[model samples]
Structures are given as C-alpha cells and as structure tokens.
Target: MADVFRSLNLLETLKESIEHNKLSDVKDAVEDLLISRINLAVIGDRGDEKATFINSLRGLSAGDDGAAPSQSPVAPEEMASYPDPKHSDFRLWDLPPAPSTSPFEPEGYMDRVKFARYNAVFMTFSQPPQPNTVEVFLEARSQQRQTVYFILFAAAKGTEKTLEETRKASLEVLTSQGVALPKVYLVRPSTLEKFDFPGLLEDMGRELPEIRAHALLLALPTLTSTLITQKKEAFQALVWAAASLSGGVSAIPVPFVASMVDCSVALRIISKAQLSLCLDDESVERLARQRGMEPTGLKALRTCALSVEVTKGEVKKRLAAAEKDLGTVSPKLVEMAMPRHARSASRSFTAMLQALGGAIEEMAADGGKIVAAALGEGK
Candidate 1:
C-alpha cells in the first residue's frame, strides 16, 4: 500500500525548482545523483510432489483394518494409488510438511525447479512439502528487496503447532541475516459475503497501519499491484481457501518478528494479524483433526473456512522457490536497519547538489573562454 509513497522521488519535486536559472546547478546535481532503482526478482524453489487421496479418515480406514498410516519407501504405484479426492490446493504452492532423513541437498534429480533468477535458495526434506514450513519462505521474501519463493515436497499443513515451528525457524534466519523486512501478504478470499474483498482490505489496512509505510517487495509488480491491490480480482480463485496469512502491511520491530518477547505493540499486531500460512482443510483433512499447537494465542491458526485456489504456473514457480530458500529476513532486522536509510536519502541528494555546482563552474569557464577567443581572434 505504501509502496507508492516510498517510491516517490524528490527529484520530481525539484523539477519546478529547475525552472529558475539560479538553481540550474542544483538541478544538474539532482539529475546526476539520480539512482536508477531496479525491481529485482529473487525466487527460491522448493520441490514438488504427488500425494494419495482418500475420503476415509479411518487412516485409509483413520484405524487397524486401516491402510498403514506411514508411507513406505518401497510402496509401489498400486499401493500408493487412491481415488482422486476432490482435493484442491491453497495459493499455488501450499505443500504438506515433508521431513528429511538426508540433509538438504541440490543434486537436481527430484528437484522440480529448472529456470531461476535472482538469489535462488532451496528448502526441503525427504518427505513431501507441508504448508507451515512453506510460510518461512514467504516470510523470507518479505524481508528481501523484491522476492518470490517456493517449497518442494513440503508437508506442514495449516496446523497450529506447525505455525509455531515455522515462526521460530523464520526468526532464527532473520536474526542471522540482518535485513529490513517487507509486508508478507497472503491473497486468500472469504466465503462469507460479509468478508467483501474491499472491506477486508480496508479492515486489514486499519489493523496494520504500517502497511501504509513502504512498497511491499514482490517478484512481479503485476501480481501484487493489479491483483492483490484489488480484493475481487485478486481473491478470485483464492476465495476457495478459508483464510491466508502474510507479514503485516508494513515492517514491524525486530523483537516482534524474532523471539516474540517483551510483548510490545509490534508483537501484538503480529500475534493477532499476520498469517503464517493458509489452505483448505476440507479437501485435504476432511475428517482429520483440524487443530494443532501454535504459540500465538490470538492468532489461532484456524482450519480455513474457504477452499484453496491457485493456477498451475503459480504452483510451479512457488515450488521452485522453496528449493532455494536457505535464510529468512525478519521485521526485527528491519527496525535495526532504519538508522541506515535515515542518513542515506539526505546525504545522497546533498552530494548530487554539490556535483551540480561543479558542472555549472565548468560550463561557465567554457563560455568565458569562447567569448575571450572571439575577441582575440577575428570572430
């Protein structure tokens, strides 16, 4: 929301000032000092997978005459085959948490992502992808300049306990990286017509006033700008899911994003508003127990009220990003970075003004020389 404001350039303000010849030197300096800002896309890849679907919670039975609860390494295609449940996924890449026996490796065989740009990071386990862990990658993207990420073979569903683990894990990464975080927003839709998209966005902005602070760092402006900005257009397919989570509209303090310690305003906002992940429990869990352990009491990671919705291409890109996410950026780090940017803007523009003065001097010298030569010669 605030992206438009942060991107606002002082140079534009100086354009009027340039009309006066007295400040032409200043204008030259401003022009010279202008830094071309680029929209860099950093994508991380997580692996992809195939999962069995069944209507019975009775464990293929959710019990003993039940199908084995554990997946077998040697299980044949026939053993794993089950009726295609009406299973739909959440925003493109919401995977179930997959655990790993082997360390995170990039051998490339099972990895689904192929083409990548930006700083690509990978995250995965031997098991298939899960929803909660995927949030970590999403969180990482928020802290970066412009990021889009993924997860392969993830296994964490939108359970409470999984959310706790995800938050802890993300905090550790942010503590290490030391970068300002961006708004991590999830674009899910609501089933209750009362949850009108525009009203929801307005309410969300009210809940997190910080969103009005800076431009959200995103992979493609089109995805967030046109779609995410509009409730109906953005939440079209996503409305299938009950709820979604993302960072606050703006970056919060480090302590809030980190330990969730000391119980501050930022922490309160994060605990209440930011969603670590979202998905359709009806399609995936059905009769399975919905609740899980989560530390954030206010933000009880609920079983989504809506169905999951996403495009195939988005799924592919998200999965690819998951494979690459090795670190996370946190709000705590962003607060710490505030001091750096404070001096950056003022100093940069001042330097440009000085440079403009020098340019003016050179121009004046050249003009004087030309006039003198004209007089000395037969001009």
Candidate 2:
C-alpha cells in the first residue's frame, strides 16, 4: 500500500513538473537516476577473502578483466578501489585491516580510510567478531552509519545448522563487546546467491537512500528470482521517470526531430534495463561460467526479443506500436492526473510508458529463466 502511494506521489510530482515547464529539473533527475555513483567499502583482514567477495559482488570472476586481483595483497595502511566493469559509477573499496593493538582507535582508522565517503560498509571476518572490528562497528554506529554489515566468509562447505551457529556466536561476541543488535551474514563468496547474502542485500536496500538503493539493485547481478523482481520494480520506477521526461520534452518546440529524441530515450532505457537484468550476452556468458554451464543453454532460455540485442530500430518500432495501442496501454491514473490542457502531451507519455514497461517485463521474465537454468532449478 505504501509503495503504491509512493509511486502515485512520484507521478503526481512529475506531472506537476511537466505542467510547470520544469523540464530542466526533470532532465537532471533522470540523469542522476541513470548515472548516480554508489561507493561500497569492504573492510577485512584477509586480502584473498576481500578480493574474492568484491569480485563476486561485481559479477566478475577472479580472472575477468577489471576484477579485483585475488593475489594482490591489500595495503596495510591504505584503501584500494575496484570499480564495477559494467557500471563504473558503482565502486568497491577495500579498506585495510583493523588495528591489532590492545587500545585500538577506530576514529583514526576510519579517518585513514575516509569512511564517510562510502554509501555502505561491509566488515568481513571468518570467525567471531574481533575486538578491533567490534570497536569499528561501534564507532560507525555512533556516527550514524547504519549500513555497516558483518560478513562471515565460510570458505568450507558447512551445514545450515553449523552456519546458523556461527552467525549466533558472532552476534554474541558483538553483544558481549557492547554492540547492540548486531547481525552477521554468513556467505560463501563462490556462491553469493546462497546463504545470507540475499538478506544482506535486502537490509542494505532498506537502509540506504532510495536512489542509491535503486542504483545498487540495478548494478548487481540477477542471481535469484527475488533479485530479478527487485530489479523489475526499480526499472518500473525508471520507466515512469523516462515516460514523464518524454512527455515534457515533446511539449518543447525544439528544432530537432522529436521522434528521433523519443527513440533515443527509449533506446537508452531499454538497453540499460537489458544489461542490468543480466539479459545481455556478456552477462549471460559470465553467469554460465560461474555456474559451470554452457552459455548456449542459458541463452536458449531467454524468450524476449529485447533480451538479446536492443537496437534503435527495435526501440523505434516498439514506440510506434505502443502509439497505436495507447488507448489500452495508457494508465488511467496518469491520464486522470494530467491537466486538461496537457492531454495532447499525454500521448507521448502513455506510449513511452507502455513501450518501456513491456520491455522491462519481458527482460525480467528472461532474467528469471536464465537464473533458473543456471541454478538447475527446473531440472
């Protein structure tokens, strides 16, 4: 119910912006939505664990280009950064190990790593929380950094009972050290879709800012059905924004071809959705490699046309087809919300909304198929 209201409120806001000729603001909002940066800091003692975790987070193998070097030792006193090859705006920073001294100063360590810059922080450890790491978590909490997470990398395959026991022990250690309500996520870096990684992402999505959460959802690999659903919601919000922008742009008396501009906007949105949903050839190949399956098998599961190659011609065709189905595809709420004078502009808005909405749904379905095939779920 809250989500529905929120979406309606956003639509109302965008409608007013378009009616008031605030096109520049709408453009800026769209640009920010598409290109915002999200910095994630991973703090851990073991270099290899941190590197492997970072690579998995970025949907890259250790040997893949731009992947964090598994063999490279993390600097003891400095931070190292690994940018997501697909989305440069999303960066993962590897922070140095916590101070081992008896009287650890978390403030100094935070300052050294420029902790305030990160959107979220992940503290990786194998065993129970160390005193130094607990101090850092306490300091982060004191500073109101609510997105900090404790990650336990269980390298060995363990039973669910053993993993649950480890998590409880870690939380007990944190509470023993005066940290309140500590939550530890036990995960195997090689299989992030398992264990508590999905829960960790859900918590992060709830804690981070709305736009940053959307960026995180779109930037992450679609490893599970839950993630694909989340990505679909995010892209739906994006489609609303793009549709509103198209309507606003059409109202302007620009010299350039309006259809060309609309096609360009639709192309960019669909192409981005394609890659984010892991429907692209490269993303599919990487997922297949990670799961030790043939890429051809996973590719065969994609039933959407836009799931493979998103070309301008296809986008234009979708837009034109949507124009003809405007009466059916157009949302009644959007039409009712528009001012009587702007009914003409609603045509472009409705068409673009329907076109992009369809594309997103198809791609999301394809993403689900690929995930199932890769995981051997249907078999």
Candidate 3:
C-alpha cells in the first residue's frame, strides 16, 4: 500500500515543488499536455453525405449555414477537413468518397489518403455497404487501424425493427468478409438526440487513445448524462495532472490574506476544467436554450464559483480536524525537508480537486434537470 502511493512520482514531485516554490517545472509539464491533437477520418460512398455526417457529428444542423453541405459535391480530387467545431485538436477529415463505379480503379486511392495517419476512421453508408465500400473498409482495416462503420438511414424509412435489420445485415456482410468487426452504429441525422448517436460517441471515446479521448470528450456537446460523466472523468484526470504541477513548482509563501497556498495553480486548473466542461455562461446558456429553457447559464456559472470556495473551505476544515491528532502521527524521512505548511498545501490541493468535482456534479445535475424538463415539455 505504501509502495502504491510512492509510485506516483509526478504527484510527489509536484507537491514538493509547490510546497517549496518551483514554478518552471510545473509550467513545462502543464504545457506538454496541452498541445496534442487527435485526427479522425470520415469516409463514405458520397462526398456530400460524408460532409453532412461530419456536420452532424459536430452538433450542427444540416440546414444551418455553418453546416457541412449535404448537396454541394466534392470534386473527385479534393479532400476536405474540419476542426471539431468545439476543439482545435480534434479534427475530422472527409476522405474522398470511395470509388463507387470502380472500387479500386484509382491506382493510388489508398496510398493517397494515408489511412494510418488518422487515429480513427469512420466508414459511413446511406444504405447497405456496397462491394466497393467494403473493399475500401477492408483496406483501411488492413492497416490495423480503429475503424467505425456508421449506417445512416432516414427517419421515415421504418420502425426500430427496420433499423435493427439494417444493422444485422451490415454485421452479416462484415462477418462474411472476414474483417474483424469494428464498432458499428445505425443513425438518423434528423433525429440525432433520439437513437444511437450518443452510443456512437461513447464507443468512439472508448476506442481512442487517452489524450485523443480526452480531447474528443471535452469537445463533444453535453447532450447526454453518459457524455457528461465521461467529460467529468477526463477532467478529473487532468486535475490530478494539475495538482502534480502545483507540487513540482518551488514553494511560495501563502499570500498574507488568503488561506490557500497555491491560488494561481488552483485557479488555472479550475479555469481549464471549466472551459473543457463548457461550464462558461455562454455555453450553459446555449445548452439551456437548446433544452427549451430561459437563460439559466449564469446561475450555473455562479454554482461553479461557489463550488471552488466550498472546496477550499472543506480543505481548511479537514486540516483543522487533523490538528488535534497531529501529536499521535509519526514524522518520516520525506517530511524532513518540507516546510511546516507543506501539509496544509497538500490538503488544500486535494480540496481544490474535490471542489471541482463537486461543482461538475452539481452542474450536471442541474443541466440534466433542465434537459428532462424540456423533453417533458416537448412531449
């Protein structure tokens, strides 16, 4: 058990630095985590259809001016790419649509696209996957890449039974082709909130690498509870990283008036988490409006601020609680060099993270209520 805690080298380094005042190391470590980008390639039978799907994935409506064109054709030679509307690091590429008339006629189709460059590939089809489509998918899979097959159908097509049939058919085809089945989803762009759209996003989150998954989750619009939880988990992991940074920086004296030791680092972590969670006023307002409520975004923002204070207060409370028992605790070699306040800073760091977690929980609960209420009103 002792070994487990000792194994967290970064956290130890972070706490030491913050307790003593080592700012440079914390800066470098934090910056290193901020710059990674995750690429996703979306390929389909038609360029226009692929673009529309891309738009839908980004949380835009097909008719919205900013939406990807569903009718505007992509020239055969062109490849289009778009940043996830919410994040620069997560990019989606519309690989030139598969060669329908001649499956492999273009000599360098596979070579030109460089399927391996992308972290994930999305193979979409409006109807059943044609031979050409399957061939391209097989080529992509041959690269040992993560590939997802999306079967998009119109809402008017049929009942849930019809959708299942389509899914089963796609499954049978892939099974017969001998391709290891990647995750598959059936969707209707018109009714995105209703069916498998959230499922598809969750599966993608599970499929991507950690940093990629983090970027993707943070960028995703908060449409479902599962998504909110994923975001919270991702953000919590990041907060640990932030705490590690605080611990690594050289220790600074606590501000004359403030009770918390490393206010700047804590604030930075909280701000970044807020941005990632879209807990900002504008984002909260937009989300509330989407669910058919008057603007309560500011109220949510206030809750986030209050959460931080609450967390700090809790940390102080814990420290006070531990004071009476300090006489019974034994000092170890690790504490020899740390200042008297080191213990307090550590407690404070923990409090900040807990506060952030509490804030997110409250925000999610409130947001869920609004969504549920709106959904009820719609019914």
Candidate 4:
C-alpha cells in the first residue's frame, strides 16, 4: 500500500537523520522509546534481607543515601518506598508482610496494595515460599503481573549443594501450582561478590523492554564486562552523532573563521556520553568507593575534565590563535587556506571523538578489573 511505503520512507529518513548526528532528531528519537515507568516492588516478611537485596539492585551499600531503609519487624501496614539512587524515575518499593489477620482475602490484599501497578514484583524469602508468599504470587500472576523469586542464602553459606537444593525446592513450589516457573535469583547479600547476581541482572534486562533495560543497565554499577560493553556501545552512537554534526559544520563557509560550526554542540555530546556511560568523575568515584578503592589511580578517569564542559574562554583563545596565524597571509593566501582549514576542523572533530572512544575503552577495562579484583575472580 502507498501508506505503508510512505511510512517506511519516513522511518528511513529518520534513521538517516539520527545516523548523521542531528541533535534534535536524535534526542526526539531517544525520548520516543522511553515511555514506560520502571517501578518494582520487593515483598516479603519483615526483615533486613529484602532491604539488602533492594540496595544491591540499586548499587547502594547499606546506609547509602536514598537506599531502601534496612529495618526489622516491619509492621503489616507499612510500605517503604525509595527512588533508585542513580535514576530517580526508577523506583523500588519495600512492601510489608502479607497481612496474616483473618478476613484477608488474597484478591482483596492484592487490590489494596495495587500490586499490579509495578513493572515487576520480587517475592523474596530466605526459606521455601510460605503459603502467604505462594498466595501472593498466584494472585499476582492472575492479575498478569511480572514476578521474580529471590532466595537469599545468607543463612546457609556452606556448600554448593545447598544452593542447588534451595533452587530446586523453590522451582518445585512454582511447578506444583501448574504455573510456569518465573525467574529466580539466588543471592547472598552478605557476600555480593559471590553467587548469581550478574546473571540475575542479565535476565532482568532480557525480560524488560529495551528502554527500561537500557536505563537499568545504566543505573547498575560496572559489575561485569558485558555491562560495560553494553554501556560503551550506547555511548558510541552518541559519539558518532557528534562527529556527524561536526562534519556538517565543516561544509559551511565564513570570512575569517576557520570553522563556522559551534564547538559547544560537540562538547555537549561528549558530556552527555560520559555521564550516560557512567564515565563521569562522580559516577566513577561512586563505583570505586563501592569496590573499596581510591578513584584516582585509573588513567581513564583523568580525561574526565576535558569531557565535562568546553568553555567559551577556551574556544575564544583557540579562535584568536587561529586568526592571528592567518593575519600575516595575503587575501589570496587566506582564500586558498579556507578549504584546508575546513578539512583541519573536521580532522580535529574526528580526533576528539577518537579520544573520547579511547577513554571509554580504558574506563571499561579499568571497571572490569576493579570488579574482578573485588570479586576475587580468577584469583
């Protein structure tokens, strides 16, 4: 149909614009995909285990600001909510214990808590799923809610066999209900360095929509190599956008100036890329502190200053220097230099992108090393 053809053409045009690094077009496209809110609920008995797991998911250690409050013996009516420490839009709720009093119909409780409103609900327990937990999951599934089971191994830190037994028993509980087995993550909160935390994150990403998944990935600390690579690729697209914008500016002509394009465009792109990729100083420092290390030793972090902001003073100084060099040349000489100057500007822009790419690579590598060291991987 003609309508279909037109739609295809429009999409192709939009893709081309994004590829060419049109800032407004790219910004709009990215925004269009981010339409859903990422809200999750961690429901279980009144204990610190649920709070600890929530903190780990948000990349917060105990006592961190904005972290899920760690408390014991929570009241049945209590609900503790906390915005993600990194991305405030993504919120996590710590729901109180399922009410044990009489006249508590599972359906009524579900409706009262508005359980279906969240993107996902994590049913956490240290032991096998209790009757109340099973009732909650069944009611949640009936309402078409996404659910994941988290079995904490803090009490049993002995053999690998214990983990396997716990997992099998947990799966059997779901199987007994004739419902499909939902995702289950086995965690040891006391020692996050061990267990299946990384795989849990990967599974969550796989299950979530692309936009929410990317946001979750960005919010997570660089705990695995795959995460670092995904973050880097996300930033690489923005880097190309910056380079494309610079290329466009190179085509313009000016009387005295070498390049007519605004350097701030490229600078803004760099700043955004650095922050989104978690390569900014504050983000890196936080991750480093989480790993119990100083942030200064990494050479990749040293280039962070250049990516923050490119000031007008620096741009003016460079322009003045370029014009001063041209002042001595004749008018004909200046005319001849214009094309070369444009080419030079393009090359400089390319070089900036290259430097940024190199820095990202270094940051990813350093982050991986830090994670490996902290986890005692390959030791």
Candidate 5:
C-alpha cells in the first residue's frame, strides 16, 4: 500500500541521513518544524477581534463574491472607508448629524473602500441639526485605523434624608449579584424611531463605531432611574444604546453592582434550582423540587441588569474600605451594610482583593490591569 511504502522510505531516509551526517536533510526537517511553530505564533498573536478584522480586510467580509479589494473600497459612505491606512486594524471616523427629515448623505472626502473609519461626525444639540456641519472626512483610510467606546451607568443610591430607605433599597438591588445590569445612553430616540441610522450615528458623534460599553452601578435615583417612575425608560434606553454599537464593536459586559448585594450570580437563565429562592415556605420547596435542586434550607439569588422581584433582606454594618471604594458609599458612616459572605470569598484572595470582594468585578478589572502591567515589566 502507499502508506506502507512511505513508512519504509521514511525509515530508510532517516537511517541513511543520520549515519551519513546529512546536514541538508537535517536543515530541511528543522525548517518544517520552524514553519509550523511560526504559524502557531501568528495565531496566538492575533486575538479574537483582530483575527476577524483580518478576514474583513481581505474583502472576505461579504459572503460569496462579496470580498472587497484590499486596495479600493466601494462607496464613500461605506463603513470600510476608514480602514487602517497602514493595514492596522483600528479606525475612528467623525461626521456631522444628517438632517432628521432626509437621508444621510455621504461626504466627498471619504475613502471609497472603507466607510466606517472614513467620517468622524461632530454632533451638536442644535434646533436644526446638520450632518457634515463643521468638518467632514479627516483623511485617507488605510489598514491602521481604529476606535472604541466606553459608557458608565452608575445606578447607586445617594444620601438624601427623606429618601434614606429608598436609597438603601436601591443600593441593595444594584449590589445584588443576581440583578441584571442595563445599558444607558443619552441618545435622541426621536431619531432612532425614524429608522435614521445616520441621525442615530449623529447622536453617537460619528466616530468609527467599535467597542461600545455600558457600566451600571450605584448612583442617585434621578441620575439613574427611579424604580417606580422612570424605570421603564431607563431599561429601554439601555437596550437601544447597546444595539446601536455594531460592526466589529464588542458590547461591554454589564457589571450589576448591588450598590448595597449584602452585595453579585452571573448569568444566562436562572436554573429551576436557582429560581426557588424567590418563593414562600411551601412554594420554595415546591419550586425546588421542580427545578431538580435540594429543597431543604434553600435560598435563591435573583440577579440581572434588571430586577427579578423577590424578597430582599437587610444587613446593616459599616462597609469596610474595599466596599466603600465603589464611589457610591457614604463617607458619612452607613449604619449597617455588611456582606459577611464577602469575607469568605476574600479569604482565598490577597488582602486588598479580599476587602473588595463585595465588588468582584472592579477588583478583577483594576487588579488585573495592574498585575499585567507589573508582570509586563519583567517580560
């Protein structure tokens, strides 16, 4: 068979090459190994987004005959107009707000190939808003263009004497691990309703849309949304804001801080086993049985960017320095806002990390960045 013959030939070649000290054969074998290693190194160097961006660069973005030429992009209004001029994968464009009533016209100074990175529109809160108003396209688009976005939505409660209880409750929910975090935007929804991508684009300030984010945490009620009154609008705004961040844009993960979780379960759907924590005595047992989790001494965690109506418990204790660092804590001593469980989680971590156990996320983020920087130096 072909396989048997190949195996015999390989063995003979290996023996003869080794016995005769054939340096050329050794060189060829090493070259093969080196090529494989380089391929792996290249893959490792390219992270998820970068790899995808490379494919898009090859005009392989569209299906079938959809690939655009790496040289010239199609329309001046195309998102590809802002490709990295140097073949880098990043870009940002700014354009003016298009007319609310009419279609958004593309500016003339754009690269016909890449649209997304071509125009950086500057938005003004004027009566008759105009796209391409002040300045239009900045420069030539190439492979090196790039951009990203970040939004912070702190839904923490504040210290208002009359609304002390309201503040505490909101804090509890925000800090609760099970609660969902919502996105926030100061978007002009009137433009959104009219299918005005350009106007919506205008609202986001026409920079190349890349990574969009929303961070929800403890904040004054009005600054966030009052649970009773503006809750609905706040929730809707969050969804719209995230949806608009598209095309190579990665939506930032929402960190649901229980301005008070006595403060964070992550997510997907709550399993039946997890849902029982919301019910009463008999109902708790019943739900537990239905969900395939143990019913005895059961407790549930209702967490999300939004609320999942449940009975909330109160804990009063001065939050340690870690919890206090969350930006919403009262410097004027809070009565009793303790997460005793946070201590257990902290037990396994460093002192500073443990103290901030109440904020699993901030600790991970800020801590990781610092650690990476420290480690990077040695490298």
Candidate 6:
C-alpha cells in the first residue's frame, strides 16, 4: 500500500510539474534515475579468486577489457578500484585484507579504505571467521552500515555436510566474537548459479537504498529468471519516468515537433534498457562465451528487434506497432493507479507509456530466453 501511495505521489508530482511547465524539473528527475551509482567494496585478500568474483559481478571475465586484474598489484594498505565496464558509475573497490594482528584495530583500516563511501561491503574468506574479520563487521555495524556481507568463496565445492559445517562454525565464531546474527553467503565465484549468490543479490536488493538497488540490478548480468523479472520491474519504473518526461516535452505547440522529440526520448530510454538487461550485442557475446557457446547461436534466441540492436528504423517500427496496440499496451495497473484528471490531460503520456512499456516487455522476454539458451535450460 505504501508503494502504491508513493507511485501515486510521484505521478501526481510529475503531472503537476508538466501542467505548470516545469519540464526542466521532470528532465532532471529522469536523468538522475537513469544515472544513479552504486559503489560496492570487496574487502578480501587480493588474489585470482577475489578478482574473478569482482569480474563476475560486473558480467566480465578476468581477460575481458576493463576487468579487474587477476593478480592485483596494490599494496596491502591501499585500495584498488574497478569500474563496471558497461556502467562506469557502478564501481567495485578491492580493499586490503584486514589487519592480521591479534588486537584488531578496525578504525584505522576502515578509515584507510574510506568504508563509508561504499554502499555495500562484501568480506570474502575461505576459512573460519578471524578476529580481524569480526572486528570489521562489528565496526561496520557501529558505523550503521547494514549492508555488509560475509562471503565464503571456494567453500561450496565440498559436500553438503562440509558446507553446512563451515557455515555453522563461521556463525558460531562470529557469535562468540560478539557479532550478532551475521549474514554469510557461501558462493562459488566461478559459477554463481551453483549456490548462495542469487540469495546474496536478493538480500542486497532488499537492504540497499532504492536507487542503489535499482542500479545494482540493472548493472548485473541477467543470470536468473528472478533477476530478469527484477530488471523488468526496474525498467518499468524508468519507463514511467521517461513517459512523464515525454508528456512534458509534448507540451510544445507544434505537434510534429513534439512527436519527433518523444521518439528520440523513447530511443534513448529503450537503448539504456537494452544495455541494462544485457540485450546488447557485446553483452550477449560475452555471456555466450562464458557459457562456452557460439555468440551467433545465443543471439539467434533473441526474437525482439530492439533486443539485439536499437536502430532508428527498429524504434520507428516498434513505435508504430505499439501505437496500434495502445489500448492494450498502456499498463493497466498504471492506468488504474493514476487519477482520471491526469490521464485525460495528456495523450502523449499514454502513447509513450504504451510504446516504451511494450518494448520493455519484449526486451525482458528476450533477456530470459537468452539466459535460458546460455544455461542450456530448455535443451
């Protein structure tokens, strides 16, 4: 109910801005939504595993351009930053390992790493909880950073019993060290589909701030159906913002001019959504390579025109098709939630909403199919 109210409030606000000719304000809001950043800090020993995990999170392999180095050269006291090649605003900072001293000093370490700047912290380890690790978690808690995670990598390849024992022992150690109810995720860095990695992303989506969570979801590769659905939801919100912006711009006196402007806005929005959902050519090829398949085969699975490329001709065709189905393509939930006055005020909003909403649905479907094909699920 609260979410519904928030959406309604946002719609009302946008409507008011459009009516009052505050298009600049609407434009700024849309821009901010599209370009939000998420800084994730990975605090672990610098090694191939840690570097591989960081690259995997960014949908890359070690040898991919802009991937984190397989062996970091930064000293133990410094931090190494790797930006997501697709989304520069989403960064991963590989911090130095926790101090190994018996008496753990968290303040100096935290300050040196600029811990507060990170939206989330992932502490990766293969062994039981060490004192320095516990101290870092405790300090993060004290600093009111609630999005910290304990990731146990390279521990999931063992038998189920061994994995359970590792988890139990880690939890017990953390409890003994006064860290209450610590969240630990056991993941195989090489294969996120194997274990707790999906759960970790779900937790982060719930815990991080709304904008950051959206950014994280869009920035990540479409690995699971759940992630594809989540990406759809995020892009739905983005489409709403973009539609509102289109409506605002349609306030221009010349109808043809307003239509042209809306088409450009729609093209930009759809292109960004394509990249976010990993429907672009490069992302598809990378995912194909990760799955050891030919890129052309994976690319063939995407049936939507906009899913593979966002050419001007494709956008026009999609828009024309959406126009014919406007009555059905306009999201029914959005229409029900919106007040009648707002709906009646702008035909352009409905048009853009239908066009972009349909494009997003098709692209999301394509993303799911690509993942399914890459994972060899339907075979």
lDDT, model 1, position 373: 32
- What would the per-residue lDDT of candidate 5 be over residues 1-379, giving only the tens digit for each residue? 1222232222234333433445345334322211211000000011222222233222223222432233324332333323322112223232212333334343443333233422222222212212332122112122232221111111123223423343344334333523234111222211111122223333432333211201111010111112112222222222111111110011112123222122211110111111211222343333344334555534322222112222222112212443345444332211111122222222111222222223222222322332223223246
RMSD of each: 26.7, 2.3, 6.7, 8.9, 27.6, 3.0
TM-score of each: 0.21, 0.93, 0.70, 0.68, 0.19, 0.90
Highest lDDT against the true fold, candidate: 2
**Per-residue C-alpha lDDT of model 6 across residues 148-198, encoded as one tens digit per residue:** 999988653588788878888888898899987777798888788768999
After superposition, which runs of candidate 4 have C-alpha atoms over 4 Å from their true positions? 1-26, 32-37, 72-75, 100-104, 147-158, 190-193, 238-359, 376-379
Please write out the lDDT profile of model 2 over residues 141-171, one tens digit for every residue: 9999899999998866677778788888998
Report, for all candidates in order, the number of backbone clashes: 68, 0, 12, 0, 74, 0
Q: Is candidate 1 or candidate 3 better by lDDT?
A: 3
Scored against the true structure, residue 32 in model 6 reaches a CA lDDT of 66
| Evaluation by lDDT, superior candidate among 2 and 4 | 2
Candidate 1 per-residue lDDT, tens place, 1-379, comes to 1232233333233322322322334323322222111111212222222221111211122232323233433323112222212211101111222233344432221132321222323233322234433444444445551333222222334444554455445545544444245222221111111112223234433332222211111111111122223322112111101000011101222223212211122122121111111122321232122222222321222321211233334333432343254134233332222223222222222222122222222322322332233223345
Give the C-alpha lDDT of model 3.
0.56
* lDDT tens per residue, model 3, 173-263: 7777766654457666544566777777767767676556656666666556556566665555555555444432223542431233245
Ranking by TM-score: 2, 6, 3, 4, 1, 5
| C-alpha lDDT of residue 16 in model 5 | 38
**Runs in model 1 with CA error above 4 Å?**
1-7, 10-46, 49-158, 169-379
lDDT of 4: 0.56
Best by TM-score: 2
Once model 3 is optimally superposed onto the true structure by TM-score, how far is the C-alpha of residue 91 displaced, in angstroms? 2.1
lDDT of 6 at 158: 80
- lDDT string, candidate 4, 203-251, tens digits: 7776666556656655555656666676666555444434434443454
Off by over 4 Å in 3: 1-29, 32-35, 45-52, 63-65, 73-77, 103-107, 154-157, 181-183, 191-193, 250-268, 281-348, 374-379
The order of the candidates by lDDT, greatest first, is 2, 6, 4, 3, 1, 5
